[model samples]
Target: PGVWDVAAKDNRGIMDVAVFRLSKKYPRANSVMTHNLPDGGHVRVASGPDGMASIWDYDIVLMGVSHLTEAMNRYRAGLGEKPGRSFRPHVSEILKFCRQSDGGRQYEAVEAALRRLKQTTVEIVRRQRGKDGRPLRVTEGAGLINDYKAVSHEDSGRVTSVEIELPKWLYAAVVEAEHPEVLTMHPNYFLMTPGLGRFVYRLARVAAGKGEARWSFRLIHERSGSPDAFKKSSAGIRELIKANELPEYDLAEEPGQDGPILVMRFRGSFPTPSTDTAGP
Candidate 1:
């Protein structure tokens, strides 16, 4: 259990889990991280110089999912459109989607993120019951992305346009599947900082949905894949709950049988745009 790749304590008991397997922690040095799913699936990620693809990198994945999901829905509505796993988006467009500024440094950061996502390796073992009632294990190893082709400006060699190919697993989950499991994120999500704040927002989105849900601090600590000591991590999470800056959600802590419990409640989403054009 002391191994860096495995959780210090068994986390399989946690009932709420996110579909996306991204690190809640900030980008760190080269290391290997792991997560043990409640359903007995295991994920191992090895990162290099750029570090593991943190939740920030997941922004790109979200964008791709949104694009494909809209395209698929349009096709389903007889819009004469075909949705594919790959997409061509301008670098500026991606930056705007992420709520980031369009600058030379930001462009460099995007390139670095792509590298980290492409270079990081993930090994997954999915356990399931076979037809004969026997345990079956399927192992797969690949990066977060299948491939990324970027077009850069000839004068400055700055990336301009990028075409990204989503992995088969992701493609199947979002576009190819009959019911895509995609969720709508708040626009303010991009304004948040990287770390537990971002991860907890996502956890609330997945676990609580439009209702209230509770999880012990210990469970959150384990599920967060945080390297900090339990006390420190819990303290940080407690602070976050008190601040309650997460968009479309309200967070609070209450006493529980096991130490303290963090509770998340849906605060509803952003307001709809008005068609009223009255002059002030």
Candidate 2:
């Protein structure tokens, strides 16, 4: 997503540095695509009674997972485990990560995203890649989240903390990374316009390793589970590059007779989280 680039506009850069680790990788988050994830998540979004993918955005799940990675890293570095799940994240911490504040509107949005994450059920099974570079086909299903709780102060009336439970699939994926980098994202990722650009960033975080990776427009469209037609999808990619929204990853379009190919390059390293703690 154009998160890191977008974040520069807001000036809140105190969040922890995030990296794309195996556990954080999901097969395009159709929530489908694969990265170096120890076992890429084979996610299939379930349709609600309305016949559309649940009002779900992978960003919420990504935010929580990113924090979980941070906490887990701290744990391995000798930090004590918090209560409930092996990883516990404070509401404020999550808010800061998602580029939101304790303001009523932002707080409500955070609560709603948390609920969507907990209520929406996805058919997600994780599989390891075979030695020959093929996915070990498997069919198992689990919810993105098992349970969650939020607490608010009665007087000031703002959510102060949050607790979440991950199903077996997620828990396994988190600890699966042999050496997790705990990929950090721009706090602005959550603020992205819900569409192709955000999904592209997720893939770049995992797929575009220390160098560059290329994908055909069709591949990105299919991976993103976008509702737009092929022509429209192809156009979107060019628009993204022109807008310069994707600052962290360098993106360019390779025009083709058949269509267009997206070339994304990641220098693989980002600036350390800024110590300027001036904004939310």
Candidate 3:
């Protein structure tokens, strides 16, 4: 758990697989992505009629997570209100939260993103323990969002407000779980340009925390759901290291048994001594 009183950026669950496309380009229609986790866990994302959801579309989920997490934090502190799965926020509020233009095009984009979230399905399977302490496989399959309703202005016909019903899994993880697997994100994350950059920041946030973490480029490529081949994917990682634009983390590369490895070291908002380490 993190400090609940101080204001900060949004939070997201530490999902091991990338459910949304990593690029801005529209994904091919009717595409399905699946990732096999090291511990035999599985994740599958199926596209909807609007095509696979892009990383930009995930901003809405971040908004929902932030709202619910704050509400839960306040409730736990004896606040009168409790968080719920359904969240109703004015459309303008969402736009501002995501740092987007408040105009017709952005509003339409938001509506489209919401529709894709409602239609796309994500299925996850992982091994867990029951009350009896026996190993059991748990499977969850549902859309990114359960449902949504947008109300439009009478004259302008622009969407004024929206009510979003989050998936049970997400709601449970954020509000119901005893120790939620969520982490506070950097405010500049929403302004990131490269899609891979955004994904890597999230990976570092969850895996590295305030320490250092390393992963082979091969594993990152697979987890990223990148359509590029191994060579291209590795090259893209090298480019990321060169660009060095991600906020709150520094990227580097080192030799590995299989290939190159990505080194993510936490550098807080202010500079400090580097605690870099070497190894697998």
Candidate 4:
């Protein structure tokens, strides 16, 4: 287990094994990173290797998730063929499924996010014992899109549809029919503004599972890639608790010998939204 994507030793078996599987999957998602964070703003962890990442402030990552979810769901439910690196869908379809604001500006926003997805890249490393009883590092680059295409009208120059190339790693996760390893995102996920609420929600969804999940400030900060001072980071958690921003889960802070520990437990059964989750 020396090559685990996450350093399991850090948690000493306290963290759920499933949570560690979130590699850009966030419980099957990829990790995130880019800048420094502070007490008042997003905390950016200064330590760690290049692979550490946190949920992005913008919901664009969700946008990409929306696309990935669709094809994967279809494949899982036996609706569509297996997906290749490229996933193609229309602009309107992407909008409707995500329940996003519609208009020229909104369309433009999607376009911008698409650009970022193509550019953003994630490096994935997995571990397994080699034949010689040695651990191995399997590294692959997980870019959001390997290729992309947008069909636009000649006269208006408006994009009509889109085609995106998915990284191989993502395609494999979605196609893993044996364990059904897909992450189920909440319907209101897209509606959530990019901030502590969404951030906490993601961590809960990915790690909390169907029961109580515990994370220390250092662990969350490590995963969060937050740069805030320790006290400031704890304060940020308090703000989420008071606001009650997390959905389908309850947040509680307890006094630990070191400091306060954050625990997230299932509020009850998570209710799936009745919104349109399919392409139009």
Candidate 5:
């Protein structure tokens, strides 16, 4: 009986045909002719106090082997094989077959592969665009409606009022752009400002509906504080506009809830305030 326990323990550890044969040959002195013995091929041997059986059956062994083989196959599939680039073409073929023969799995697989291909292609194109500058068209204009100005007394700084003329098209664009903060400062007069090269660039973007352009300008200033400085600058802007024949607009100054702000009047309607403006 003691040897039976030892044999059971050995069988539990080794779990082999050789160990079973050894246990059967070396029977213990007190061993009863128990049916529940490992040596008896048909009997299920009781190993512990809980009466748990230590049965080494063919079916269990076969199942374990199957599971191990499956695991190895999965590992090899993941690491050993490289995914083929022809996957998309293959998937497309399968999808065609599915459409013709009504195979659901093939159709689904093809759809998924096509989606993945599209995403990958978009990413590649985006990367290429980032490396290169965005393809955009640029338009240049000499003069554009920037700001309004009037003559001011050198002593009192009171504005000697003057009316400004704005182009219809320029007015429409400015109104559409919605710049209002430009008028809030309430300078005495509408200043003839330089052609806004940068503003023109942004406007070009709006016009083209893609990419961006940059504008640069050179300005002539008589004196820093002279009220006439704006008036003089206006002449240059006017000349540029006239030479370019660019459509211009009027930026009307009005009182806002916060303070004075410029409004763009295009056609009959006054649009929203512009975000782009110079100065406080």
Candidate 6:
């Protein structure tokens, strides 16, 4: 019955005949090609429009399946009651080995864990706030407050300026520590903020060796009677000397005393060009 079907050759054509004959001769071969056939059993004929036939052996495929089965069995055995529970024990064993090998470095491990946790927490907070909402504060202290005012000019709509007032005592202390001589040089002294200080220093440098160059110094209250008391005072005097190399100046013993004041003046000229007009 099979041979009759093979000879009938429906849409499958001659390939069916070749497959059937190969199957009959080699029941256990699992594949068939003319080159592998022995002696008289082999048959060669002219190539059809479909061309040559090739076969592949399934030995490697069978071997791969066997290996996969063995691996699955071993994995199941290791899991005991659990089917696929190797991951947790593997990780736990690794951690145990690390701890046993480097017991003294536990502090470093804890610190690393804390840092990771902090980063994750910060990320979560940022995600919760989104872009429009107020951001999370990382520090305990209050941040700086800014007060701005705008002034209008004839040519410009408005120019904005900011007034920043910090803790008075903190500013006073810093000034005292940084420039004590300002106390004796001028009764009324002002300490510029860090940003303004840079501009002031630049102006002072430019005015060097100019007519009556004036410099500003800082003063603090704490150095009332210390040896470094004179340091701040000297800085102020040095600035005054640079102002114009004044031959004579008076220094006061107390902060509020009337003494020599450093004055700075700025002068410039402006000129407009014009063409001559002819009269009729």
Models 1 onward score TM values of: 0.84, 0.67, 0.88, 0.69, 0.14, 0.15
Clash number by candidate, in order: 0, 11, 0, 23, 17, 13
Write model 5 residue lDDT over 188-218, tens digit each, in one string.
1112122232122113222222222222111
Residue 233 alpha-carbon offset, candidate 6, angstroms = 4.1
Global fold similarity of model 6 (TM-score): 0.15
- Write down the lDDT that model 6 would get: 0.23
By TM-score, the best candidate is 3
Q: What's the residue-level lDDT of 182 in candidate 2?
A: 42
Residue-level lDDT of model 3, residues 163-217, one tens digit each, is 9999888888777777764666676887887888888988987788788999999
User: TM-score-based ranking, best first?
Assistant: 3, 1, 4, 2, 6, 5
lDDT of 4 by residue, 25-49 (tens): 2321234453222322221121123
lDDT of 1 at 227: 74
> Candidate 2, overall lDDT?
0.52
Candidate 6, position 195, lDDT? 17
Superposed model 6: Cα runs more than 4 Å off:
1-230, 240-257, 268-280
Worst 10 residues of 6 by lDDT: 3-12
Query: Looking at model 3, which ten-residue stretch has the lowest summed lDDT?
Result: 271-280
Error of 3 at 98 (Å): 0.8
Model 2 C-alpha lDDT per residue in residues 1-280, reported as the tens digit of each score: 1121212211011011111111222222323322222356445544222222222234445554544454454466666463134344666566565565557766655565555555445453557687899977666655556777778888876777766776665544544545433455555456776356666766666567457887778777665555558787778888888885763788988876667888888744554444222111
Residue range 106-171, candidate 6, lDDT tens digits: 323322322221121100001124367965432211101111122233464322221222222222
Q: Each candidate: what lDDT?
A: 0.69, 0.52, 0.78, 0.51, 0.24, 0.23
Q: RMSD in angstroms, candidate 2? A: 8.7
lDDT of 1 by residue, 1-280 (tens): 1111110111111224322333444565577767787669876777778677766776777777666665665576677487777888888878887878999888878887888788777787789999999999989877777789988888997998888987777677666656555665667777988467877877787788789889888888777767778999788888897788998899999999879999999988544223111100
| Model 1 local distance difference test score | 0.69
lDDT of 3: 0.78
